[model samples]
Target: MIQNQHLFHIPVMGTGHSIDTPIRIAHLGINSVVSVVDDMLCEKIRQHYSSVHNIAYQNIPKSAADGRAERITAYLNLMADIVGQKFDELKKMSLLEGTEKDRYFRLLPESNPLRKSYDKIASLTNQAVRQNLIKEITGKMTLGSIDVNIMAKVDALKMGDDGQPLSSEYSDASSALRGYANSKLSSSLVLSAGFNPRLYSYLSEFKDFYRDKTGDIKKKIILKVSDFRSALIQGKFLAKKGLEVAEFRIESGLNCGGHAFASDGYLLPVLLNEFREKRNQLKETFQPMIQSFYESQGWEYPELSEEETTPKITVQGGIGNNGEMRRLLEEYGMDATGWGSPFLLVPEATCVDELTSKVLANAAEKDLYLSNVSPLGVPFNNVRGTGSEKYTRELVEKGKPGSKCPKGFLVSNTEFTEEPICTASAEYQLLKINSIQESDISDEEKENQKNRVMDKTCLCTNLGTGSMIRLGIMKPSYGRQAICPGPNIAWFNREYSLDEMVDHIYGRRESLVPKERPHMFAKELTMYVDYINELAILADPEDAEWKKLLRMKKNLDAGMELCMEIAKGSSYEGENLHSLQSTVEEQKLRLAEIFNLVPSEA
Candidate 1:
């Protein structure tokens, strides 16, 4: 019912207020991760944040070239551990100089042929970026026999800066709002990382570098292989991989939820429903390497035996997805529609409507919508930003706001609306809704095709600020019948919890909706049950829903004496009332015998 008791709730960020703390999903951009030398909140997130989830057109930690070989391998492993402790404190005070002097300071050689000529210029810049030549100016600038033992030991000593060097890129905005509050977020952030460029042009321009644009940004590139030196250089070579590209990004307009992110709701119709369900067992089992990136940069090649580009599809417009917004409104046929944050009213927000699926389904607990807007915390504090912004206003300055504000309205989410009842800790709520209506919002002037489909989702302004009080008692309890269909959603959207949908909103089960169609009353099921009981939160919400149903019936009746001390560890994944099963084992038949294969034992 209240979206099946909002799956145990937990989108934290505290400070008083818990009038039964509902939901208010905020954390949009915050000056693109806080700072790259505070270009003044990146000029107000590039002048009042326009959205494609705009992080002022992101490319986090910027300067690419694999961020110059990850800042020259972390500036030569901290200048080879501070020049092996200033060459063992300048040769234990004897101060060794000019070659032939050897025998003196031995602390320097952890096999340093100038660190193998900077690992042969980061392996020839990953072989000229796997050959698409990501602007490769030069190739092997020397590592031949390790530069004769690095110009005879850096011509006998002299490099400084022990704290290392290339220390620049910084931006944290509370670790990008705690990675958008771990989860329960929908107000924005899709990011996905990049740098694949056709496996960086098939291992450095060796041959098929997007084979004469037949590559299509090499399958909309998303080869994200985080660390361990880019997973031992590109996740052990794109690890077997599959699906080369289907990058769909649609929007031909309308998002903040009036719908229209089409191309079958993103993943480009699951990559054309998995290339028409694996076009004939993929050349007898797996070597596909697909490609397709056409912002209409001339669209020609389609012979496609199965590769030249059938599997290749880049089409990026911007998305939520609808076969990438009906394939760019049937390739430029266009109605344009958009309305970000339902033209702003904020309190549990909602409005969404690909045209059906009961959006905001009658926003029940009273159509939530709260962010009157405030967290003005981050703006500069970047110190390389990790552990998700552990709060470093130079290490924890608390109530930030050192500057910026004398120009316009800088405080809103209702001037810190308080109602704090306490039982608190990680308090935060930011509502959403209103995706586009009033006939897909048009203050027209002729730039037709619904003004290029309402210039794809009317660039952002999303709002949020929460401490709960059901977003101030459901923002005027559904009055103004006002727009708000879907903005900043968070009922744990993996499309309402992948199919199980908690046994279809708990009638014990039965609500995927088409059982020969009967469930009446619509307006998208009363705006999705008034945006889930106005984001009603109650997983022990300070008891009283009958003492929280007698403490969930005495904590599920000693839930197995709290699951028999869960193997003595007591809680987290264990203690399920003493039945224990999960040490954690979904499936990994040694993952095909760790790839050597042939291990299907079941």
Candidate 2:
């Protein structure tokens, strides 16, 4: 049902980096996600692109009712228009060398029948037959989905100026969903960062989410999950309301960019294996519930085939090369692979400014680490030497810390004030720091705690600053950009063209990473090892902590065993399969050190 010529998609980066990715590359038949978390960012991008495309633009002011949803809808509609125009033009272009049509087919996977057909047709000796076949092939061409993402947890309740909470419909996540639902774009809405009950319930209100009379879903749902159990749980909940999840996008908990949702030590390969084994259970469990809901509503449930009703299973997070991607498709049975962090370097695809782009390009493995910079209290993947890091530290040195809290999207704390405030806000930090100094604790411990408190940066605004800077909407001096790139970013040390990156994905080009780069599974194993090692060091696991740590240890051990089996099996080139064995053996030693420090569970 979710058919596309290409095998890979660009996952949502930060709130800003891939905000306008569809406008840039959807015409090329490559799917990409836009984060609708910050509607102001959407409005700004919409305004900028509207000018660039010479389209009439209208500003949706903040005071306007349903402004957030309006902003998102307007931006998405504009993108739909622009991408539609470009794709139509590309389809009409001649199949000459270096033309868009040539690039479009050339970018398809080697196994794609259309690409193979294009190659064979291009070699036809007869002009008339070739021309007719070309028309047929071009007619079959489809546009890449202009998908959007909603971080379900960022659904903060909005308040009116009269000091009363707005209706649940006006919440952050609800507004975003409303925006996408109201849009004219026929694409999927990816819900990431765990599930929200209210947001999930709101999906039932949109008629487009349901199967039409012709058994077509005008707009689909893609749940970005971390494990098989999560996929089953979330998928069933949506299905109970007659909402079908078109795809289950599995992302590595720790190996991904943005907020790292570390699982209970379940590694990527182990998770994938579970999904592979139990992928059928997802549809089997959801189908009946969906049918029941439709029947209760007195709506006809289309007699769709099983394949059409089945949810797609795709994987992302730290997918570095073609070999890993192929294994995910052939070995583990994924629908498609999502290449995320690598696209940060592809300017034609992502919107990263020059200053932040340089930092991402030259960053080494050591420079990229899991940081505590996110106000959501989640571990964020961060790089060193960014304008944001420098600015936050400088403010601390100057006796001023935290952001101005211009955008309160991440606000969830209400420790001192009646109204909630962001942890990265200046007022909250000042109050927290004063409270910490007044507490009865060791000087050294207080300093450490204060440093952690000061580390919370303005991700709500700063994440979008790079896009603003890149678009020339904001000056460099005003751009305190905060970028989140996964550890896989270290292997790529320079900018890449869209053609080069797409070619690399299909194995038409040579490996972009170093030969020493670890396999995605092996790399994920090391990160989990480091995570537990740090936890084992910090955790005073006298009772409950010991049990949690022990449970995590068991999961890690099981994952390592699976990795060993995979390493011993047949491998594709550039998979770095050997790294799995070595990494497992090496990490076993580290695990031993951690357990040595941690006492056995009672």
Candidate 3:
């Protein structure tokens, strides 16, 4: 009887492929299918659930003498009903959690019995795609070069505002991760590649293009515990992933770090338990790696802090039956951890609801043009708002070499590059700029009013309002298609967006786009640099104190950048690592010159 309740659900890719013309096929219909499924479950629950131990049990148990029997019966019924209904859900969720992909499970609709069961679900998802609920990708690699581009875009927006670059391309839009798209809409981001550093190497490409195009480089941090034997490793990994996501929030950037892992104790507990005699010897091997992230204040000096909320590990029960799994992840503490796949499986059941709909909406928006090209979907950095990337800025500069830029396009690299959105943005002239004053007209009283009719500008306050419709739900809508039109083709080659393609080809990314607020970032930075330069002129070049401060800033940037570059760089091996050190050293000297902090002794 319970077996008959078993229902299979087919998952469909949202990368839209044009069946004929504009009504591109896709996944926005997922909600309807889910609702249908939910309805069936509700009916089943009502029909099969015993009044004894279900929620019904609570009320009856108080009156019933032999409540135990009622509880047991209800519990059994609940378990059976859940098991049958959850078969596909659990299966999908499990696959999402692991690094492995069976492909067969992902393609359940192609078969007979499984296909029949999932037909309705599959058709709905397919309808969403066919309707262009999915956005498109350009197949552009975005990992390698990111920061420079983000920075460039940021700079371009300001310079354009101040007539530094093309005066027409000035957008003062700012964006935040887990935020809405309209207020501070963006089209790209640069960030740490993700947790599986050993697998992907695409960050450099993003870095170069993004910086060159002026996209934001979302920064991420990692803390890992290296003890392996105690099985605490999973916690460490989860911690790193969790913390990395937190760091993105901490830095006012779009949350993109989903791969940072904790490995601090990955090797310690294992060695301590298994090779007690050689524990000291093993330290020799891992110590160098750990010690390099030097903390003058202590082990928790900078990014490696035990003060953070450790990743709540769920895998220990099923990820690993042993006790030592989480301990191993803790050994190598990582701030940035993974959450994308987990969220994808049961977005409704996840604790990370803030960025879920934003990312999905963004992904759906970008999937339009990419449908003819891939199945991995596309990246949502644009709508998510590309972050503080050096290269992203460079890229923007490259695009709008004239000097002044536009306003709405500030946080977006797509406007400056070969993107899919066909928006005809007109740079406003002499924008009447002033923060909303709360004392007189705009206050708590106007909260709802402002959100209702307020023009979508580049302010965090306003953007949140705009995203109200887009967040928390992953279905694609008109907003998603603002940037790219999916395929003009089919599901086999369709990639809704670049981010999706990256995910499909590489995996969940670790990098995130930081916040983009409608403000003068480049102008502000330039002002600060000018003030420092003026101070440098006043102070003697050989002044030791000034040199120290400059050196200090350099050290800070070096450390921050190193973490970023290491996290950002595609190739973390040999010459690249050595080259990173040298690059930082060189930048340190440049900082000294900028601040007039040259070596006094010399």
Winning model by lDDT: 2
Instruction: Give the whole-model CA lDDT for all candidates, comma-separated.
Output: 0.23, 0.91, 0.24
Give the Cα-based TM-score of candidate 2 against the true structure. 0.98
Predicted candidate 1 versus true structure: per-residue lDDT over 445-522, tens digit per residue: 232322222111100111111111123322322221112233222221223431132223222343333222211111
Model 2, position 150: C-alpha lDDT score: 95
Q: Given candidate 1, what's the lDDT at residue 526?
A: 24
Winner of 1 and 3 under TM-score:
3
**Deviating ranges (above 4 Å) for candidate 1:** 1-168, 172-359, 363-462, 465-501, 505-508, 512-602
lDDT of 2 by residue, 368-439 (tens): 999999999999999999989988998999999998998789999999998889999999999999999999
Candidate 2 residue 538 C-alpha distance from true site, Å: 2.1
Comparing 1 and 2 on lDDT, the stronger one: 2
Q: Which ten residues in a row have the lowest lDDT in candidate 3?
A: 17-26
- In order of lDDT, best first, we have 2, 3, 1
How good is model 1 by TM-score? 0.21
Candidate 1, residue 452: the lDDT equals: 25
